[model samples]
Target: MTLGLTGLLALGLATSVLAQDYQRPSISGIGAVAQPEQIAAWDIDVRPDGLGLPVGKGTAEDGEALFADRCAMCHGDFGEGVGRWPVLTGGHGSLTEERPEKTVGSYWPYTSTLFDYIYRAMPYGDAKTLSPDEVYALSAYILAENQIVEYDQELNQDNFAQIEMPNRANFFADDRAVSEAYSERCMSGCKAEDINIVSAAPELDVTPEE
Candidate 1:
Protein backbone atom coordinates (compact mmCIF):
# COMPACT_ATOMS: atom_id res chain seq x y z
CA MET A 1 0.00 0.00 0.00
CA THR A 2 2.88 2.39 0.85
CA LEU A 3 4.62 1.61 -2.44
CA GLY A 4 1.38 2.19 -4.40
CA LEU A 5 0.87 5.54 -2.62
CA THR A 6 4.47 6.65 -3.38
CA GLY A 7 4.01 5.78 -7.10
CA LEU A 8 0.68 7.72 -7.23
CA LEU A 9 2.30 10.82 -5.60
CA ALA A 10 5.21 10.74 -8.06
CA LEU A 11 2.76 10.44 -10.99
CA GLY A 12 0.74 13.40 -9.71
CA LEU A 13 3.89 15.53 -9.26
CA ALA A 14 5.08 14.64 -12.79
CA THR A 15 1.64 15.54 -14.23
CA SER A 16 1.66 18.89 -12.39
CA VAL A 17 5.16 19.66 -13.66
CA LEU A 18 4.15 18.83 -17.22
CA ALA A 19 1.06 21.04 -16.91
CA GLN A 20 3.16 23.93 -15.57
CA ASP A 21 5.69 23.53 -18.40
CA TYR A 22 3.04 23.96 -21.11
CA GLN A 23 3.50 27.09 -23.15
CA ARG A 24 0.60 29.40 -24.02
CA PRO A 25 -0.09 30.42 -27.62
CA SER A 26 1.91 33.49 -28.63
CA ILE A 27 -0.47 34.64 -31.35
CA SER A 28 -1.75 38.24 -31.01
CA GLY A 29 -4.59 40.08 -32.75
CA ILE A 30 -3.88 42.22 -35.82
CA GLY A 31 -5.26 45.31 -34.09
CA ALA A 32 -2.53 45.16 -31.45
CA VAL A 33 -0.39 47.47 -33.62
CA ALA A 34 -1.24 50.20 -36.08
CA GLN A 35 -1.45 49.05 -39.67
CA PRO A 36 0.83 50.53 -42.35
CA GLU A 37 -2.21 52.06 -44.04
CA GLN A 38 -2.95 53.92 -40.80
CA ILE A 39 0.16 56.05 -41.30
CA ALA A 40 -1.99 58.84 -42.63
CA ALA A 41 -3.66 59.21 -39.23
CA TRP A 42 -0.55 60.43 -37.35
CA ASP A 43 2.51 60.49 -39.58
CA ILE A 44 3.46 64.14 -39.24
CA ASP A 45 7.25 64.46 -39.19
CA VAL A 46 9.66 67.00 -40.72
CA ARG A 47 12.89 65.27 -41.61
CA PRO A 48 16.26 66.82 -42.39
CA ASP A 49 16.74 67.86 -46.03
CA GLY A 50 12.99 68.56 -45.93
CA LEU A 51 11.72 65.11 -46.84
CA GLY A 52 8.48 64.63 -44.92
CA LEU A 53 7.56 68.23 -44.03
CA PRO A 54 3.96 69.20 -44.68
CA VAL A 55 2.39 72.22 -46.42
CA GLY A 56 1.28 75.26 -44.30
CA LYS A 57 3.22 78.28 -43.16
CA GLY A 58 3.82 80.16 -39.92
CA THR A 59 5.87 83.25 -39.22
CA ALA A 60 7.71 84.03 -35.95
CA GLU A 61 5.24 86.80 -35.19
CA ASP A 62 2.38 84.41 -35.69
CA GLY A 63 4.03 81.87 -33.38
CA GLU A 64 4.48 84.28 -30.47
CA ALA A 65 0.81 84.16 -29.52
CA LEU A 66 0.78 80.37 -29.62
CA PHE A 67 3.89 80.22 -27.46
CA ALA A 68 2.49 82.52 -24.79
CA ASP A 69 -0.79 80.63 -24.65
CA ARG A 70 0.60 77.08 -24.91
CA CYS A 71 4.32 77.00 -24.08
CA ALA A 72 5.34 79.88 -21.76
CA MET A 73 3.85 78.10 -18.72
CA CYS A 74 6.59 75.45 -18.66
CA HIS A 75 9.33 76.70 -20.98
CA GLY A 76 9.19 80.30 -19.68
CA ASP A 77 8.57 83.40 -21.80
CA PHE A 78 12.09 83.38 -23.26
CA GLY A 79 12.53 79.59 -23.34
CA GLU A 80 14.71 79.51 -20.20
CA GLY A 81 12.83 76.50 -18.78
CA VAL A 82 10.85 76.28 -15.54
CA GLY A 83 11.75 74.03 -12.61
CA ARG A 84 12.83 70.74 -14.27
CA TRP A 85 11.21 71.32 -17.66
CA PRO A 86 13.58 71.49 -20.61
CA VAL A 87 15.22 74.72 -21.63
CA LEU A 88 14.43 75.44 -25.25
CA THR A 89 17.56 77.49 -25.99
CA GLY A 90 21.20 78.13 -24.96
CA GLY A 91 23.97 75.60 -24.03
CA HIS A 92 26.21 76.99 -26.79
CA GLY A 93 29.53 75.79 -25.30
CA SER A 94 28.53 72.96 -22.96
CA LEU A 95 28.99 70.06 -25.40
CA THR A 96 32.64 69.31 -24.48
CA GLU A 97 31.91 69.24 -20.73
CA GLU A 98 30.91 66.16 -18.69
CA ARG A 99 27.84 67.70 -17.04
CA PRO A 100 24.22 67.58 -18.25
CA GLU A 101 24.56 69.94 -21.17
CA LYS A 102 21.27 70.37 -23.05
CA THR A 103 18.87 72.69 -24.87
CA VAL A 104 16.81 72.45 -28.01
CA GLY A 105 19.53 74.48 -29.73
CA SER A 106 22.31 72.29 -28.34
CA TYR A 107 21.09 68.72 -27.86
CA TRP A 108 18.38 67.78 -30.35
CA PRO A 109 19.67 65.77 -33.31
CA TYR A 110 16.84 65.64 -35.84
CA THR A 111 14.39 68.46 -36.37
CA SER A 112 11.67 65.92 -37.11
CA THR A 113 11.83 64.60 -33.56
CA LEU A 114 10.90 68.07 -32.38
CA PHE A 115 7.71 68.30 -34.44
CA ASP A 116 6.78 64.73 -33.51
CA TYR A 117 7.47 65.10 -29.78
CA ILE A 118 5.53 68.35 -29.49
CA TYR A 119 2.66 67.30 -31.69
CA ARG A 120 2.27 64.06 -29.71
CA ALA A 121 2.90 65.62 -26.31
CA MET A 122 2.60 69.29 -25.43
CA PRO A 123 0.53 71.99 -23.60
CA TYR A 124 1.14 69.95 -20.35
CA GLY A 125 -2.40 68.65 -20.09
CA ASP A 126 -3.90 68.69 -23.56
CA ALA A 127 -2.03 66.74 -26.22
CA LYS A 128 -2.97 66.46 -29.88
CA THR A 129 -5.22 69.44 -29.30
CA LEU A 130 -3.13 71.80 -31.36
CA SER A 131 -4.03 71.97 -34.99
CA PRO A 132 -1.32 71.39 -37.57
CA ASP A 133 -1.27 75.11 -38.21
CA GLU A 134 -0.86 75.84 -34.50
CA VAL A 135 1.94 73.29 -34.23
CA TYR A 136 3.75 74.88 -37.15
CA ALA A 137 3.37 78.28 -35.55
CA LEU A 138 4.60 77.06 -32.17
CA SER A 139 7.50 75.26 -33.79
CA ALA A 140 8.42 78.38 -35.69
CA TYR A 141 8.35 80.42 -32.51
CA ILE A 142 10.56 77.94 -30.65
CA LEU A 143 13.03 77.79 -33.54
CA ALA A 144 13.32 81.55 -33.60
CA GLU A 145 13.88 81.59 -29.83
CA ASN A 146 16.72 79.09 -30.33
CA GLN A 147 18.13 81.32 -33.10
CA ILE A 148 17.99 78.41 -35.54
CA VAL A 149 15.70 80.40 -37.84
CA GLU A 150 15.24 84.07 -38.55
CA TYR A 151 12.33 85.94 -36.95
CA ASP A 152 10.78 86.79 -40.30
CA GLN A 153 11.34 83.31 -41.65
CA GLU A 154 8.33 81.14 -42.26
CA LEU A 155 8.09 77.47 -41.26
CA ASN A 156 5.86 74.66 -42.40
CA GLN A 157 6.23 71.10 -43.60
CA ASP A 158 7.92 72.66 -46.65
CA ASN A 159 10.74 74.42 -44.81
CA PHE A 160 10.75 72.98 -41.29
CA ALA A 161 13.67 70.58 -41.79
CA GLN A 162 15.89 73.32 -43.26
CA ILE A 163 16.19 74.95 -39.84
CA GLU A 164 19.51 73.41 -38.78
CA MET A 165 20.15 72.90 -35.06
CA PRO A 166 23.23 74.61 -33.53
CA ASN A 167 24.57 71.43 -31.91
CA ARG A 168 23.70 69.09 -34.75
CA ALA A 169 27.36 68.60 -35.58
CA ASN A 170 28.31 68.00 -31.93
CA PHE A 171 27.39 64.29 -32.04
CA PHE A 172 29.34 61.63 -33.91
CA ALA A 173 29.10 57.86 -34.25
CA ASP A 174 30.55 55.95 -31.25
CA ASP A 175 33.52 54.06 -32.70
CA ARG A 176 35.66 54.12 -29.58
CA ALA A 177 37.77 51.26 -28.18
CA VAL A 178 35.02 50.51 -25.64
CA SER A 179 32.76 49.23 -28.41
CA GLU A 180 35.25 46.48 -29.39
CA ALA A 181 36.49 45.75 -25.83
CA TYR A 182 33.33 43.92 -24.77
CA SER A 183 33.52 41.39 -27.62
CA GLU A 184 37.19 40.52 -26.97
CA ARG A 185 36.72 39.51 -23.31
CA CYS A 186 33.90 38.45 -20.99
CA MET A 187 34.87 37.69 -17.34
CA SER A 188 38.51 38.70 -16.92
CA GLY A 189 40.31 41.93 -17.95
CA CYS A 190 37.08 43.43 -19.29
CA LYS A 191 37.55 46.64 -17.40
CA ALA A 192 39.69 48.45 -14.86
CA GLU A 193 39.17 48.43 -11.07
CA ASP A 194 37.32 51.26 -9.35
CA ILE A 195 39.67 54.17 -8.73
CA ASN A 196 37.44 56.81 -7.13
CA ILE A 197 35.54 56.71 -3.82
CA VAL A 198 32.06 58.28 -3.53
CA SER A 199 31.61 58.86 0.19
CA ALA A 200 29.17 61.62 1.18
CA ALA A 201 30.54 64.91 2.42
CA PRO A 202 29.87 66.03 6.02
CA GLU A 203 26.72 68.08 6.45
CA LEU A 204 26.92 71.63 7.81
CA ASP A 205 25.57 71.99 11.39
CA VAL A 206 22.91 74.62 12.02
CA THR A 207 21.81 75.94 15.45
CA PRO A 208 18.11 76.37 16.27
CA GLU A 209 16.73 79.87 16.77
CA GLU A 210 16.31 80.93 20.45
Candidate 2:
Protein backbone atom coordinates (compact mmCIF):
# COMPACT_ATOMS: atom_id res chain seq x y z
CA MET A 1 0.00 0.00 0.00
CA THR A 2 1.11 3.55 -0.73
CA LEU A 3 1.04 6.46 1.72
CA GLY A 4 -0.09 9.97 0.86
CA LEU A 5 2.01 13.04 1.87
CA THR A 6 -0.08 13.66 5.04
CA GLY A 7 0.16 9.90 6.05
CA LEU A 8 3.95 9.97 5.54
CA LEU A 9 4.24 13.08 7.71
CA ALA A 10 2.05 11.40 10.42
CA LEU A 11 4.21 8.20 10.40
CA GLY A 12 7.40 10.29 10.69
CA LEU A 13 5.91 12.17 13.69
CA ALA A 14 4.97 8.88 15.43
CA THR A 15 8.49 7.51 14.79
CA SER A 16 10.04 10.66 16.26
CA VAL A 17 7.79 10.42 19.37
CA LEU A 18 8.77 6.77 19.89
CA ALA A 19 12.46 7.64 19.57
CA GLN A 20 12.07 10.38 22.23
CA ASP A 21 10.43 7.88 24.69
CA TYR A 22 13.56 5.64 24.85
CA GLN A 23 16.17 6.73 27.42
CA ARG A 24 19.21 4.76 28.75
CA PRO A 25 19.88 4.36 32.48
CA SER A 26 23.04 5.99 33.87
CA ILE A 27 26.01 3.59 34.10
CA SER A 28 27.25 5.05 37.40
CA GLY A 29 28.60 2.51 39.98
CA ILE A 30 27.83 4.59 43.08
CA GLY A 31 26.34 2.19 45.68
CA ALA A 32 27.96 1.37 49.05
CA VAL A 33 28.86 -2.26 49.94
CA ALA A 34 27.00 -3.91 52.84
CA GLN A 35 29.12 -4.61 55.96
CA PRO A 36 29.47 -8.09 57.50
CA GLU A 37 27.53 -7.02 60.60
CA GLN A 38 24.54 -5.93 58.46
CA ILE A 39 24.62 -9.18 56.48
CA ALA A 40 24.79 -11.26 59.69
CA ALA A 41 21.82 -9.36 61.10
CA TRP A 42 19.65 -10.48 58.15
CA ASP A 43 21.02 -14.04 57.90
CA ILE A 44 18.74 -15.50 60.60
CA ASP A 45 17.74 -18.87 59.18
CA VAL A 46 17.20 -21.92 61.47
CA ARG A 47 17.72 -25.39 59.99
CA PRO A 48 15.56 -28.50 60.55
CA ASP A 49 18.46 -30.30 62.29
CA GLY A 50 18.35 -27.71 65.10
CA LEU A 51 21.23 -25.70 63.63
CA GLY A 52 21.33 -21.88 63.97
CA LEU A 53 19.12 -21.87 67.06
CA PRO A 54 19.89 -18.90 69.31
CA VAL A 55 20.98 -19.43 72.92
CA GLY A 56 17.88 -18.99 75.07
CA LYS A 57 15.33 -20.83 77.21
CA GLY A 58 11.58 -20.65 77.81
CA THR A 59 8.84 -22.77 79.38
CA ALA A 60 5.22 -23.25 78.34
CA GLU A 61 4.14 -21.55 81.56
CA ASP A 62 6.18 -18.48 80.59
CA GLY A 63 4.96 -18.75 76.97
CA GLU A 64 1.27 -18.56 77.92
CA ALA A 65 1.68 -15.06 79.32
CA LEU A 66 3.77 -13.90 76.37
CA PHE A 67 1.40 -15.45 73.84
CA ALA A 68 -1.60 -13.76 75.44
CA ASP A 69 0.15 -10.39 75.34
CA ARG A 70 1.65 -10.60 71.83
CA CYS A 71 -0.25 -13.26 69.85
CA ALA A 72 -3.73 -13.78 71.34
CA MET A 73 -5.32 -10.99 69.25
CA CYS A 74 -4.87 -13.03 66.09
CA HIS A 75 -4.15 -16.64 67.19
CA GLY A 76 -6.69 -16.60 70.05
CA ASP A 77 -6.22 -18.10 73.51
CA PHE A 78 -5.20 -21.78 73.31
CA GLY A 79 -4.28 -21.17 69.63
CA GLU A 80 -7.89 -21.66 68.40
CA GLY A 81 -7.58 -18.71 65.96
CA VAL A 82 -9.62 -15.53 66.07
CA GLY A 83 -11.95 -14.13 63.36
CA ARG A 84 -10.72 -15.48 59.99
CA TRP A 85 -7.22 -16.07 61.41
CA PRO A 86 -5.47 -19.41 61.03
CA VAL A 87 -6.35 -22.11 63.59
CA LEU A 88 -3.22 -23.31 65.34
CA THR A 89 -4.71 -26.18 67.39
CA GLY A 90 -7.09 -29.12 66.94
CA GLY A 91 -8.07 -30.64 63.52
CA HIS A 92 -6.22 -33.80 64.57
CA GLY A 93 -8.03 -36.04 62.02
CA SER A 94 -9.29 -33.79 59.23
CA LEU A 95 -6.45 -34.07 56.73
CA THR A 96 -8.56 -36.21 54.34
CA GLU A 97 -11.82 -34.35 54.88
CA GLU A 98 -13.35 -32.02 52.26
CA ARG A 99 -12.14 -28.92 54.15
CA PRO A 100 -8.91 -29.88 55.84
CA GLU A 101 -7.91 -27.86 58.86
CA LYS A 102 -4.14 -27.64 58.59
CA THR A 103 -2.83 -26.57 61.99
CA VAL A 104 0.76 -26.58 63.27
CA GLY A 105 0.03 -29.67 65.36
CA SER A 106 -2.05 -31.63 62.85
CA TYR A 107 0.03 -31.10 59.71
CA TRP A 108 3.56 -29.84 60.39
CA PRO A 109 6.39 -32.40 60.46
CA TYR A 110 8.96 -30.78 62.72
CA THR A 111 9.13 -28.68 65.88
CA SER A 112 12.16 -26.85 64.48
CA THR A 113 9.96 -25.65 61.62
CA LEU A 114 7.58 -24.12 64.16
CA PHE A 115 10.42 -22.42 65.99
CA ASP A 116 12.00 -21.13 62.78
CA TYR A 117 8.73 -19.76 61.44
CA ILE A 118 7.81 -17.94 64.63
CA TYR A 119 11.30 -16.56 65.00
CA ARG A 120 11.26 -15.16 61.47
CA ALA A 121 7.58 -14.30 61.08
CA MET A 122 5.12 -14.04 63.96
CA PRO A 123 2.97 -11.51 65.88
CA TYR A 124 1.66 -10.49 62.38
CA GLY A 125 2.99 -6.91 62.18
CA ASP A 126 6.19 -7.17 64.19
CA ALA A 127 8.70 -9.40 62.39
CA LYS A 128 12.00 -10.56 63.89
CA THR A 129 11.68 -8.44 67.00
CA LEU A 130 11.14 -11.08 69.68
CA SER A 131 14.06 -12.37 71.74
CA PRO A 132 15.21 -15.98 71.45
CA ASP A 133 13.76 -16.78 74.85
CA GLU A 134 10.40 -15.31 73.78
CA VAL A 135 10.35 -17.42 70.61
CA TYR A 136 11.03 -20.58 72.66
CA ALA A 137 8.27 -19.73 75.07
CA LEU A 138 5.82 -19.09 72.26
CA SER A 139 6.71 -22.39 70.60
CA ALA A 140 6.15 -24.22 73.87
CA TYR A 141 2.77 -22.56 74.33
CA ILE A 142 1.56 -23.54 70.87
CA LEU A 143 2.87 -27.08 71.35
CA ALA A 144 1.14 -27.35 74.70
CA GLU A 145 -2.07 -25.93 73.26
CA ASN A 146 -2.06 -28.68 70.62
CA GLN A 147 -1.40 -31.32 73.33
CA ILE A 148 2.06 -32.06 71.99
CA VAL A 149 3.65 -31.18 75.37
CA GLU A 150 2.77 -30.45 78.98
CA TYR A 151 2.33 -26.86 80.20
CA ASP A 152 5.42 -27.16 82.37
CA GLN A 153 7.62 -28.16 79.44
CA GLU A 154 10.65 -26.04 78.61
CA LEU A 155 12.06 -25.75 75.08
CA ASN A 156 15.57 -24.62 74.34
CA GLN A 157 18.29 -25.32 71.81
CA ASP A 158 19.33 -28.41 73.80
CA ASN A 159 15.85 -30.00 73.94
CA PHE A 160 14.30 -28.57 70.76
CA ALA A 161 15.35 -31.61 68.71
CA GLN A 162 13.76 -34.11 71.12
CA ILE A 163 10.19 -32.87 70.53
CA GLU A 164 8.69 -34.77 67.59
CA MET A 165 5.55 -33.67 65.79
CA PRO A 166 2.53 -36.02 65.47
CA ASN A 167 2.25 -35.74 61.69
CA ARG A 168 5.91 -36.53 61.05
CA ALA A 169 4.90 -39.99 59.76
CA ASN A 170 2.67 -38.44 57.10
CA PHE A 171 5.71 -36.87 55.45
CA PHE A 172 8.09 -38.99 53.39
CA ALA A 173 11.24 -38.41 51.43
CA ASP A 174 10.64 -37.26 47.83
CA ASP A 175 10.86 -40.08 45.24
CA ARG A 176 9.57 -38.42 42.09
CA ALA A 177 10.71 -39.84 38.74
CA VAL A 178 10.62 -38.36 35.26
CA SER A 179 8.28 -41.11 33.97
CA GLU A 180 5.94 -41.23 37.00
CA ALA A 181 2.57 -39.50 36.69
CA TYR A 182 -0.19 -38.82 39.23
CA SER A 183 -2.89 -39.67 36.62
CA GLU A 184 -2.20 -43.38 37.19
CA ARG A 185 -3.02 -43.08 40.92
CA CYS A 186 -6.57 -43.94 41.95
CA MET A 187 -8.17 -41.06 43.87
CA SER A 188 -11.34 -42.51 45.35
CA GLY A 189 -14.44 -40.29 45.86
CA CYS A 190 -12.92 -37.57 43.67
CA LYS A 191 -15.52 -38.00 40.89
CA ALA A 192 -17.78 -35.17 39.85
CA GLU A 193 -21.03 -35.75 41.74
CA ASP A 194 -23.83 -33.23 42.21
CA ILE A 195 -23.73 -31.74 45.69
CA ASN A 196 -25.80 -29.21 47.64
CA ILE A 197 -24.50 -25.63 48.23
CA VAL A 198 -24.31 -25.43 52.00
CA SER A 199 -22.90 -21.90 52.05
CA ALA A 200 -23.09 -18.80 49.83
CA ALA A 201 -21.78 -15.31 49.09
CA PRO A 202 -22.76 -12.45 51.37
CA GLU A 203 -26.07 -10.65 50.67
CA LEU A 204 -24.39 -7.25 50.45
CA ASP A 205 -23.08 -6.86 46.91
CA VAL A 206 -19.94 -4.70 47.04
CA THR A 207 -18.67 -5.66 43.58
CA PRO A 208 -19.02 -3.45 40.55
CA GLU A 209 -21.59 -4.69 37.95
CA GLU A 210 -19.66 -3.38 35.01
Candidate 3:
Protein backbone atom coordinates (compact mmCIF):
# COMPACT_ATOMS: atom_id res chain seq x y z
CA MET A 1 0.00 0.00 0.00
CA THR A 2 2.85 2.40 0.82
CA LEU A 3 4.66 1.60 -2.50
CA GLY A 4 1.47 2.07 -4.49
CA LEU A 5 0.79 5.45 -2.80
CA THR A 6 4.38 6.52 -3.52
CA GLY A 7 4.04 5.51 -7.22
CA LEU A 8 0.74 7.34 -7.56
CA LEU A 9 2.22 10.47 -5.94
CA ALA A 10 5.21 10.30 -8.26
CA LEU A 11 2.95 9.94 -11.33
CA GLY A 12 0.80 12.84 -10.17
CA LEU A 13 3.88 14.98 -9.62
CA ALA A 14 5.24 14.05 -13.08
CA THR A 15 1.92 14.92 -14.69
CA SER A 16 1.83 18.27 -12.88
CA VAL A 17 5.40 18.99 -13.96
CA LEU A 18 4.56 18.12 -17.60
CA ALA A 19 1.51 20.31 -17.52
CA GLN A 20 3.56 23.21 -16.09
CA ASP A 21 6.24 22.73 -18.80
CA TYR A 22 3.81 23.33 -21.64
CA GLN A 23 4.06 27.11 -22.22
CA ARG A 24 3.66 29.41 -25.27
CA PRO A 25 5.93 32.26 -26.22
CA SER A 26 5.06 35.70 -24.87
CA ILE A 27 4.63 37.27 -28.32
CA SER A 28 2.03 35.65 -30.68
CA GLY A 29 -0.54 38.29 -31.66
CA ILE A 30 -0.80 40.08 -35.07
CA GLY A 31 0.87 43.17 -33.61
CA ALA A 32 3.84 41.16 -32.34
CA VAL A 33 5.27 40.78 -35.88
CA ALA A 34 3.97 44.09 -37.25
CA GLN A 35 6.19 47.19 -37.34
CA PRO A 36 4.00 50.28 -37.64
CA GLU A 37 6.81 52.73 -38.45
CA GLN A 38 8.29 50.65 -41.33
CA ILE A 39 5.23 51.33 -43.54
CA ALA A 40 5.47 55.15 -43.34
CA ALA A 41 8.13 55.42 -46.05
CA TRP A 42 6.15 53.32 -48.56
CA ASP A 43 2.75 54.93 -47.85
CA ILE A 44 3.23 58.19 -49.73
CA ASP A 45 0.10 59.20 -51.63
CA VAL A 46 -1.64 62.51 -52.37
CA ARG A 47 -5.43 62.77 -52.38
CA PRO A 48 -7.93 65.11 -54.01
CA ASP A 49 -8.51 68.53 -52.39
CA GLY A 50 -4.70 68.67 -52.18
CA LEU A 51 -4.53 66.69 -48.97
CA GLY A 52 -1.05 65.19 -49.33
CA LEU A 53 0.93 67.52 -51.68
CA PRO A 54 4.33 68.33 -50.27
CA VAL A 55 5.47 71.94 -50.10
CA GLY A 56 7.13 73.12 -53.33
CA LYS A 57 6.74 75.40 -56.35
CA GLY A 58 7.31 75.07 -60.11
CA THR A 59 6.35 77.15 -63.14
CA ALA A 60 5.07 75.82 -66.43
CA GLU A 61 8.19 77.16 -68.13
CA ASP A 62 10.45 75.30 -65.73
CA GLY A 63 8.26 72.22 -66.14
CA GLU A 64 8.69 72.41 -69.92
CA ALA A 65 12.45 72.40 -69.55
CA LEU A 66 12.41 69.46 -67.15
CA PHE A 67 9.90 67.59 -69.28
CA ALA A 68 12.05 68.01 -72.38
CA ASP A 69 15.08 66.62 -70.61
CA ARG A 70 13.59 63.84 -68.47
CA CYS A 71 9.95 63.22 -69.42
CA ALA A 72 9.87 63.85 -73.19
CA MET A 73 11.77 60.63 -73.97
CA CYS A 74 8.72 58.58 -73.03
CA HIS A 75 5.86 61.13 -72.92
CA GLY A 76 6.85 62.84 -76.18
CA ASP A 77 7.77 66.52 -76.59
CA PHE A 78 4.06 67.60 -76.76
CA GLY A 79 2.93 65.44 -73.78
CA GLU A 80 1.61 62.82 -76.21
CA GLY A 81 2.54 59.37 -74.94
CA VAL A 82 4.94 57.29 -77.03
CA GLY A 83 3.77 54.44 -79.32
CA ARG A 84 1.66 52.56 -76.75
CA TRP A 85 2.42 54.25 -73.43
CA PRO A 86 -0.52 56.69 -73.19
CA VAL A 87 -1.70 60.16 -74.26
CA LEU A 88 -1.63 62.86 -71.58
CA THR A 89 -3.54 65.64 -73.29
CA GLY A 90 -6.95 66.02 -75.05
CA GLY A 91 -9.99 63.67 -74.50
CA HIS A 92 -12.05 66.59 -73.25
CA GLY A 93 -15.61 65.41 -74.04
CA SER A 94 -15.09 61.69 -74.65
CA LEU A 95 -16.07 60.44 -71.18
CA THR A 96 -19.76 60.20 -72.17
CA GLU A 97 -19.03 57.68 -74.93
CA GLU A 98 -18.82 53.90 -74.63
CA ARG A 99 -15.06 53.75 -74.93
CA PRO A 100 -13.52 56.98 -73.72
CA GLU A 101 -9.77 57.37 -74.12
CA LYS A 102 -9.26 59.13 -70.82
CA THR A 103 -6.24 61.37 -70.31
CA VAL A 104 -4.77 63.47 -67.50
CA GLY A 105 -6.83 66.49 -68.47
CA SER A 106 -10.14 64.80 -69.31
CA TYR A 107 -10.59 61.83 -66.97
CA TRP A 108 -8.81 62.91 -63.82
CA PRO A 109 -11.26 64.37 -61.35
CA TYR A 110 -8.72 66.44 -59.41
CA THR A 111 -5.64 68.30 -60.64
CA SER A 112 -3.80 67.42 -57.45
CA THR A 113 -4.02 63.72 -58.39
CA LEU A 114 -1.79 64.47 -61.40
CA PHE A 115 0.91 66.02 -59.24
CA ASP A 116 0.55 63.20 -56.75
CA TYR A 117 0.80 60.40 -59.33
CA ILE A 118 3.70 61.95 -61.27
CA TYR A 119 5.65 62.95 -58.21
CA ARG A 120 5.36 59.50 -56.70
CA ALA A 121 5.75 57.30 -59.81
CA MET A 122 6.91 59.16 -62.94
CA PRO A 123 10.07 59.16 -65.13
CA TYR A 124 9.29 55.36 -65.45
CA GLY A 125 12.81 54.12 -64.71
CA ASP A 126 13.90 56.23 -61.74
CA ALA A 127 11.08 57.01 -59.32
CA LYS A 128 10.94 59.21 -56.14
CA THR A 129 14.17 61.02 -57.15
CA LEU A 130 12.65 64.32 -58.29
CA SER A 131 12.80 67.22 -55.89
CA PRO A 132 9.60 68.95 -54.84
CA ASP A 133 10.45 71.79 -57.24
CA GLU A 134 11.06 69.35 -60.09
CA VAL A 135 7.79 67.53 -59.42
CA TYR A 136 5.93 70.83 -59.42
CA ALA A 137 7.60 71.81 -62.71
CA LEU A 138 6.82 68.45 -64.32
CA SER A 139 3.21 68.78 -63.17
CA ALA A 140 3.05 72.28 -64.63
CA TYR A 141 4.39 71.21 -68.01
CA ILE A 142 1.98 68.29 -68.25
CA LEU A 143 -0.93 70.50 -67.27
CA ALA A 144 0.10 73.09 -69.88
CA GLU A 145 0.34 70.44 -72.60
CA ASN A 146 -3.11 69.26 -71.59
CA GLN A 147 -4.25 72.92 -71.95
CA ILE A 148 -5.63 72.88 -68.41
CA VAL A 149 -3.41 75.75 -67.37
CA GLU A 150 -1.38 78.48 -69.11
CA TYR A 151 2.33 78.06 -69.81
CA ASP A 152 3.36 81.05 -67.66
CA GLN A 153 1.39 80.16 -64.58
CA GLU A 154 3.27 79.22 -61.41
CA LEU A 155 2.18 76.08 -59.54
CA ASN A 156 2.88 76.14 -55.86
CA GLN A 157 1.46 74.57 -52.71
CA ASP A 158 -1.13 77.33 -52.46
CA ASN A 159 -2.35 77.58 -56.07
CA PHE A 160 -1.86 73.96 -57.14
CA ALA A 161 -4.73 72.83 -54.92
CA GLN A 162 -7.00 75.61 -56.13
CA ILE A 163 -6.69 74.77 -59.85
CA GLU A 164 -10.15 73.51 -60.78
CA MET A 165 -10.36 70.45 -63.03
CA PRO A 166 -12.95 69.97 -65.78
CA ASN A 167 -13.90 66.56 -64.40
CA ARG A 168 -13.98 67.60 -60.78
CA ALA A 169 -17.58 66.50 -60.35
CA ASN A 170 -17.40 63.64 -62.84
CA PHE A 171 -16.58 61.00 -60.24
CA PHE A 172 -19.13 59.63 -57.79
CA ALA A 173 -18.45 57.29 -54.92
CA ASP A 174 -20.09 53.81 -54.73
CA ASP A 175 -23.81 54.58 -54.45
CA ARG A 176 -24.93 50.92 -54.47
CA ALA A 177 -23.97 50.47 -50.84
CA VAL A 178 -25.74 53.60 -49.64
CA SER A 179 -28.44 54.44 -52.24
CA GLU A 180 -29.27 50.97 -53.66
CA ALA A 181 -29.84 49.20 -50.35
CA TYR A 182 -33.50 48.69 -51.28
CA SER A 183 -32.59 46.95 -54.53
CA GLU A 184 -30.24 44.59 -52.75
CA ARG A 185 -32.86 43.78 -50.08
CA CYS A 186 -35.72 43.16 -52.57
CA MET A 187 -34.54 39.64 -53.55
CA SER A 188 -37.32 37.79 -51.70
CA GLY A 189 -38.29 35.55 -54.67
CA CYS A 190 -34.89 34.40 -55.88
CA LYS A 191 -34.91 33.57 -59.63
CA ALA A 192 -31.66 31.85 -60.62
CA GLU A 193 -32.75 31.55 -64.29
CA ASP A 194 -33.35 35.29 -64.57
CA ILE A 195 -29.72 36.06 -63.76
CA ASN A 196 -27.78 37.56 -66.68
CA ILE A 197 -25.18 34.95 -67.59
CA VAL A 198 -23.84 37.11 -70.43
CA SER A 199 -22.63 39.84 -68.04
CA ALA A 200 -21.13 37.62 -65.34
CA ALA A 201 -19.04 34.54 -66.05
CA PRO A 202 -19.55 31.66 -63.61
CA GLU A 203 -15.95 30.49 -63.44
CA LEU A 204 -12.77 29.99 -65.46
CA ASP A 205 -13.47 27.22 -68.00
CA VAL A 206 -10.08 25.72 -68.71
CA THR A 207 -11.46 22.78 -70.74
CA PRO A 208 -13.46 23.18 -73.98
CA GLU A 209 -16.68 21.93 -72.51
CA GLU A 210 -20.10 22.60 -74.10
**Best-fitting candidate, scored by lDDT:** 2
CA-lDDT, candidates in order? 0.77, 0.87, 0.80
Q: How do the residues 78-180 of candidate 1 rate in per-residue lDDT, one tens digit apiece?
A: 7888898879877767877888558877788767777777778888789878776777788878778878888888777766786677677768888777666
> Comparing candidate 1 with candidate 2, which one achieves the higher lDDT?
2
Candidate 2 lDDT by residue in tens digits, 1-210: 888999999988877745577887887888778999997888777877888788898989999989999999998988899999989999898999999999999999998888888989887899888999999999999999899998898889998867889998998766675445456655787668877877566665766787
Give the Cα-based TM-score of candidate 1 against the true structure: 0.66
Cα-based lDDT at residue 175, candidate 3: 85
Q: lDDT rank, highest first?
A: 2, 3, 1
Clashing pairs in 3: none
185, model 2: CA deviation in Å? Answer: 18
* Residue-level error in angstroms, candidate 1, position 206: 18
> lDDT tens digits, residues 63-160, model 3?
88788888787778887778887788888899889978788888887887888778788778888889889988888888888788888898988889
Report each candidate's C-alpha RMSD, comma-separated, in the order given. 8.9, 10.0, 7.7
Give the lDDT of residue 134 in candidate 3.
92
Candidate numbers, best TM-score first, in rank order: 2, 1, 3
Deviating ranges (above 4 Å) for candidate 2: 1-36, 173-210
Worst 10 residues of 1 by lDDT: 200-209
Query: In model 1, which runs have C-alpha deviations exceeding 4 angstroms?
Result: 1-37, 98-100, 176-198, 201-210
